[model samples]
Target: MKSLLSLLLASLLSVFSLPGLAQTPEAQSLLASVLALKPNAERGEAEFVAQACSACHRKDGSGKSAGNTPRLSGQHGAVIIKQVLDIRSGLRHNPPMQPRVTEQSLSLQTLADIAAHLQALPISGTIAKGPGSGVARGKELFAKDCAGCHGANGQGNQATFVPMVAAQHYGYSLRELEFIRDGKRGNSNRAMASLIKTYDQDDLLALADYMAQLPAPQRK
Candidate 1:
């Protein structure tokens, strides 16, 4: 499994060289392995707490906005798995998460379990929002630029690995948008980066605000 994971990491690195490319064979294999595992949410909850994830993400998975941490509650399990694997493989540059998301600390099964647990959690608690001034423009911008891929309601496509941005904190969203625009976020989708690069700071602020104000998706 470790060898397989190593190969997966190499495949992920190749993405940096070929943006918008299809997944490599090794990446597909790792995804299959993760999908094959029967995630144990109960065990995941324990690991979430034990791994000190609760410290930043909160016990409920409503992440800290002041810290620029994103809300993880109700996110798709596959998306979570992909991001964590990216972090572990150095495809994503998250220094704080790097230590905790190591291969030894989170094996594929444990990672899958954690993702399931987080996905099952309800998205509750107060989300930090942007100022009201830009909401109208933000809404317009969202319709014109973002709604196609992210959906009209920002309920991201789980199968495509697009994260649910509705109800996310404005501060975090703005920061990440800036990072993607500036090419600072290594794992960002190239198309998104290019599109966001066209936006000014105020556009980003409005976009983030609009996204933050969107209602959270109703979970079954």
Candidate 2:
């Protein structure tokens, strides 16, 4: 009975301790910098472009239109690194992204190396726009559902883990909404999940269209 009880206690302790094992952006960054194990920019660049990351996000970090993937240009390196880790940890849901991030290895060094390379890319100036019957409907949905944390303008609060959406590539923005709806993105973002849960397919599309017309976010 004592042995069985001890085993049960150990199982409970492991379950409770998993969160502490999650990699932090700071941890990944420090390790990459200190160990000099970050993949060279050249290697990372090749890997990024050659790998499927470029397909949805664009080669110049401009972003795609069909996939609703976002512009990856000029994102904070730490934030970028953490996102990949979050997806793997199921803190964010992304079955598609999970495979890629964990494909080679889900180590912190690999995440940091990819982030470093992406951060160095030149920004694309292609702003998004939308015009259609659904624009007004999309705007209404944004006002009612999305504007609180993402701002009325879709400029997100990074501190809140709310990503900027104003002038984000329509494809990328739509993708984000889809992920939220499917419970594949923003696992840690209660507000986002709640907002998305109330959204239908048309609502998601409209939100994407409306956000496409907003002004670009100011980078730090």
* Winning model by lDDT: 1
Best of the candidates, TM-score: 1
Could you tell me which residue pairs clash in candidate 2?
Answer: 68-171, 68-172, 68-175, 69-171, 69-172, 93-184
For residue 82, give model 1's deviation from the true position in Å: 0.5
lDDT of 2 by residue, 35-64 (tens): 334446666667676666888777777776
lDDT (Cα, 0-100) at 40 in candidate 1? 96
Query: What are the lDDT figures for the candidates, one per model?
Result: 0.83, 0.62
Q: Which residue ranges in model 2 land beyond 4 Å of their true spot? A: 1-52, 103-107, 116-122, 125-130, 184-188
Clashing pairs in 1: none
